[model samples]
Each structure stands twice: as structure tokens, then as C-alpha cells.
Target: MKVGITGASGYVGQFIVRHFLQRGYTVRVLLRNVQKTKIFCAPDGRFEWTCGDMSNDVVLSEFVDGVHAVVHGAYDHLPGRYRGGEGDNLTGFLESNLNRSLALMQLAHGAGVEKFVFISSRAVYASGHLRGNLQEHSAAQPDTFYGAYKAAVEAMVSAWAYQLHWHAVSLRLTGVYGVVNPLARSKWYDIARAVVRGEEYSQGRNATEVHGDDVARAVELLLHEADARGQAVNCSDRLVSNREIAEIIQSISGERGPLPPQAKAVSPAVMDCAYLQRKGFRFGGVGRLRQSLRELVEAVQKEQRSSQ
Candidate 1:
């Protein structure tokens, strides 16, 4: 089967490309710039690249043509926070993300793609203190522009699936950490860097973490499994406090810096992935989390030494 992916150069997209390639599936990556593809695809020549921007209908249609499935991972963040009286940020985010996603959906449908997988966020659920496990059918009250945009897209994808008879899977992902590019800044990276630098760090309340490889594996499982169709699954694992994560990095890196004092600890935001697991999707669990963090720390240190 041939699979097409947007945002093929991103942290998540790269893993998906590699996952499909290892499984002997033909993969086509939609990249705006061909040069960017060379950097990531240099290690392997298994995947093909199609030059196109998501906004271009012609390009999108061409990219999706003859593909069994398409995974939409591209998301554009607004210039400013989508809060307060200034609704401009929300407008920009919707135009770039929601609008682009809708266009891509239509293009994929027109191209007769069999399945469409959208990587949504866990933020779509109602925000407060997550008192219990958050399931797929949980109430959602997106408070921010980013969350609102994702929620809207999720609804759009579901509607499109019903009307077009297309298999749509929206995976609501939590904090995904793994072997991302060293240059990419994530919460995990930030905490790891602080530990390595022996700098003071502050822990935030309510942060959930998941390994990127586990996320990639989940996507792979969904791609082959017909049961994942027409369903929205939450993808996450056990929650870890920010300070605990920092300490883990320090331990793995062999850094001798004194662990920062624990800040206020808040209730963990639990995302239940029971539906996904029932469909035969598996994660690396706590072990995978440790391994991913170790690999990330080693990669960061290696890059740091090389830079010096």
C-alpha cells in the first residue's frame, strides 16, 4: 500500500515515514521544499517525495493520488496567543490550520483515498483539573485558540468521513517526547537542557508525556487495522512530573548537578487509550519513556560536543 503524509519533515512525520518504510510500504512525503527532504531522507532512500504546499489544491490532489491513506500532521501556530480581546490570533490559526485541513480533506476525498488519519491534540477535552481518566467520549470545552482549532478540525473530519464514507482516525496525542531533531525545542528538550546546563528550572503543573516512537507505533497500528477507522483515540501514557523528568535526564546524562527543588505539583491530566489498545495498538510504556529520554539526552550531548 502507498501512503502519503503531509508535514513530512516534522518530528512526527519523520517517524511515520520511517515506520512505514520498515514495513515495506511505499511512502510518499509531501514537502514544500525538496531540499528539506534531503536532510531527513539521507539515511534511507526507501521513500519518495512530492513537492507541494498544502494550500495548493492541485498539488494536494496530485500528492494524494493513488495513495491508500494520508496522514495529516501539518499544523501552523498563530503569531500570537489566541487569548484576550484580540481574536486575530484565532483567525490566523483557523485560516492556516482548520481551513487548510478542510481543503486537504476535500482533496483527499476527491482523490479517492481509502483512509485519512488526523493527529489531533489532547487539548480538545475540557480543561480544569482532570479529576479522572479522560476517555474518547469526554466533554470538550476548548479554552484556547489552538485547542478550539483542533476541535473544529476533529468535527470536520468526522463529518467528512460520514458523508464521504472515508475511514477517518483522529488520534488525540499528549506530550510526545523522543528522538526529535536536536534543534527542535520541546518541553522535554527544555527540561533536559536545563539539567545539562546545571541551570535553575521550574516545574509546571499538569504535564503528560508520551514517547514519540510509541506514537509512531500507534500510527502504524492504526494504518493497518481497519478497526481504527471512524474512531478518535487518545494516545498517551502515565504522567510524569516536570521535576521528575528533569531528574531522569540528569541521571541518564550522568550530570552531577543538584536536583532542583520540587515546585507545586498538580493533578495529572490522564488520557485513556483503552479504545486504541483494544484495537491492538501498543506503546513502549514506562520503559519506552525511559529509553526515549536516555536517547534524547545522549543525542543532545553528542550534538553539543560536536558543536564545541
Candidate 2:
């Protein structure tokens, strides 16, 4: 099987590449910068990297040729930073994220790619607070521009699957972490560092955590599982409070920070993974969280030592 992934150098994209390689699939990564691919690809040269942007018709066409499946994991939304530069604000974000994704989907279809897997976000649901468990069929009310863009693209994927006869799977991911680069700061790493320093960390009311490896595994399963087609699965593990997450970070990082005062408890936006569970998607839950945090801390320490 040949699988092509957009944003192959990203945290999620790199993990997907690793997963596909471990499963004996020939992987191709679509990256704008060839230099970035060097950091992720194995020196054995088992995988191929194509240089191109998703919005380019010629590039997108050539990138998906002869690939069995394509996983759309690239997006422009930097977790805490605004990436879309000065322009029609909405258009810039949409072009970089949603429109580019749609174009890639079309290219995949034209190239006879068997399956298209999209990594969406749980933020598509309403923002106030999740009153109950969020099921796949729940109403979507995205509050942020990033969430709105994901929701919009999801709708397009669904339409193409049903009307255009394309096989598609959209996985609404939540709190994917475990990619701890000393130079880069993800939400999880930032929170961990803050807790380690005994600093007060303010975060959004709705957040859930999932290991990046686990998320990649889930996507792999969805790609191979026949029943996953034409379905939107909500992917997440246990619902952990912000305070609980902070405590876990402290415990794993050996950070002796004082716990922050309990702020107002926010309603949980828990994802209903019943469908994934029924499909035999078993994760280590909070244990996965702990293991990921420990790995991140060790990685940070190692990098610090090397720098010194």
C-alpha cells in the first residue's frame, strides 16, 4: 500500500508516517520544504518526499498519483499563534487550511486514491461547555475560526463521500500531544513547563488530551477498517480536568510546583468514542497521557543537557 500525507513534517504527520512505515506501507510525504523532510524520514530511504503546496493544482495532481490512500493532516492554524498574514483575514485562513484541503481531496479522487482520511478537531462542537457527551451525530456550533474551518471542511468531505462516491473518514481529534521539541512549544508542552515552574496557567474552558501516537494509530485503523468509510468518528480518551492535567504533568516531570487554586469548573466537552470502541479502538487512556508526559519531560531534559 502506498500512502501520501500532507504536512508530513508536522507533529501529527510525522507520527502517521512512522505508523504507516511500521505497518509495511510505502509512504510518500508532501512537503513544501525538502529540508524539513530530512528531520523526519528514515535514513534508509524507505519513504519518498515530494515538494509541493496543497493549493497548487499541478503539485497536488502529481503528489497523489498512484497512492492507495491520502491522509489530510495539514492545516494553517498554529495552536496559540495566528499564521494567516495580512489579507482578507477569513480568506487567508480558509485558503491555507480549508480550501487547500478541499483541493487535495479533489486531487485524491481524480488520482483514484481509495481512501481519504481527514484529521479534524473536536472544537467543531459548541464552545460554552459540553453539557453531555458529544456524539458523532451531535449538532456542530464552532466558536473559533479554526473550529469553523474544520467543520466546514468536514461538511464538504461528507458531501463528496455520499454524492461523489468517494470513500472518506473524518476523525475529530482532541488534544493531541507528545511531540516535545525544545524549539517548538505546543499547548501540552507549554502547560507542562508552566506547571513545572509553579506558574498559573490559563487555558480554554474546553480541552481534552490524546497522545499523538494513539491518534495516528486510530487513523491507521480507520484507513484499513471497512466500516470506517462514510463515517465521522469522535476520537478522544478520558475526560481530564485542567487541574488534574496539571497535577499529572507535575507528577511525571518531577516538578515541585504548588497547585493553582481551583478556578471555576468548566463543563466537560467529552467526546463519545463509543463508535471507535465498537470498532476495537482500545487506548491506554490516562496511562497513555502519563507515559507521553514522562517522555516529553525526558526529551526536554536531554535537549537541555545537550545545549549545555
Candidate 3:
């Protein structure tokens, strides 16, 4: 099977690409600048890449051609567009991501792709206090433009699949953390460094998170399951608090510093992946988060030693 992935150079996209490649699937990556992704492109013949902006019709057409599935992970966020939670550059962000998303959906449908997987967000769920349980069928009451845009595209994709007979799966993901390379962003590292330096760390709001590899695994499963068609499955694993994360970082890094105070009792927003579990998908996000953080500390130590 051939899978075409947008945003293949991004943090999440890289994991998805590696996942499919490891599974022995022919992967086609669409990027804005292929030259910038040299590290991601393996010499292995199974990977094909094209460089073009998503707004171009010719690019979209060429990308979808002969691909059995499409994974949409393209999102554009402008600097200072979002402050607090609401966005200020609503129009620019929407035009860049949402419009292109609709266009991609239309193009993928037209090109006879067997399956389309959209990387949606858990923020699509009602966002106020983060107290309620979120399920696959939960009502969408987005609090931010980012969430609103994702929710809108999810609806559009589902409607398109239902009316046009296209197989679609929208995986609503939460915070994703993993470190495959130096470019990988893992918040655990930041906290560990801060603790090691005895610096004051910010105690921010907490949310459910999943590992990036686990998210890619979910995508792999959805691509092959016929029952996943037109389904929006929650991809989050477990709710983790900021204090817990800080403690874990401190323990793993063996650093004793002014860690942030324990977070107050807020209603933890736990996302239900029961629908995905019912389909025989076992989640390893929360279970492996600690191990991943430990590995990250080890990687940092190794990098420091190599540099020295």
C-alpha cells in the first residue's frame, strides 16, 4: 500500500512517515521544501517525495495520484496568532490551514484514494474548565480558533465521506510527546533542564497527552480497518498533571531544584479511547511516557558527552 502524507517534515509527520516505512508501506511525502528534509528521507527506494505548496492544484493532483491513502497533518500557526487560548490572526491561520485542508479533501476524494486520515485535535471538545470526560461522540464546542478550525474540517471530512462514499478517519489527538532526533520536541526535557539548573518552572495547565509513536500506530491501524471509515476516534491515552510531569522529570534527571508547586485540583479532562480500544487497538501513551522521558534524558546525556 502507498500512503501520501502532508507535512511530512513536521514533528508528528516524521513519526508517521517512519511508522509506515517500518511497516513496509510505500510512502509519498509532500513537503514545501524537499531540500530541508534531507535527514528524514531514507536512501531506501520505498520513499518518494515531492516539493510543492498545498495551495497549488497541480501539486495536490500529482501528490494524490496513485496513492492508496492520504494522511493530512498539515497545520499552519503564525507567531503571536494565539495568546492565552484565543487566536488573534484568525483569518490568516484559517486561510492557510482550513482552506487548504478542504482543497486537499476534495482532491483526495477526486483521485480515488481508498482511505483519508485527518489528524484532528482533542481541543475540538468543549474547552472551558477541562473537567468533563470526552468521548468520540462528545459535542464539539471549541474554545479557540485552532480547535474551531480543526472541528470544522473534521465535520467537512466526515460529511464528504458519508455523502461521497470515501473512507475517512479523523483521529482527535491530545498532547503528543516523543524524541526520535534532536529536532524532536519533548517538554520533559525542558522541565528536567530547568530543575537541574534550580530555576523556577512554570506550573501550567495540564491536559491528556499521548506519545507520538502511539499516535502513528493508531493511524496505521485505522488505515487498514474498514470499520474505521467515517469514524472520529479519540487518540489520547491518559490525563497527566503538570506537577506529576515535573516530578517525573526531576526524578529521571536526578536533579533537585525548585520544581513548580503541586497543581490545584482542577477537573481533569480525560479523553475516552474506548471506541479505538473496541477495535483491538491497545494504547501505550501513558504507559510509556515515563520510559520515553528517561530515554530522552539518556539521549541528552549522550549528546552532551559527544559534544564534549
Which candidate ranks first by TM-score, i.e. highest? 3
TM-score of each: 0.89, 0.88, 0.91
User: Against the unseen true structure, what C-alpha lDDT does each candidate score?
Assistant: 0.76, 0.77, 0.80
What's model 3's lDDT at 144?
74
Residue-level lDDT of model 1, residues 54-158, one tens digit each, is 778888888898888899998765332323322556566567788989998888888889889998888788666566788898766777667777788888877
TM-score for model 1? 0.89
Relative to the true structure, candidate 3 reaches a TM of: 0.91
lDDT of 2 by residue, 40-149 (tens): 64636568878878768998888899899999988765455432222357777788888889889988998899999998888788766567788898877887777888
What is the alpha-carbon lDDT of model 1 when measured against the actual structure?
0.76
* Winning candidate number (lDDT): 3
What are the C-alpha RMSDs, in order, of all predicted structures? Answer: 2.7, 2.8, 2.4
lDDT of 3 at 38: 76
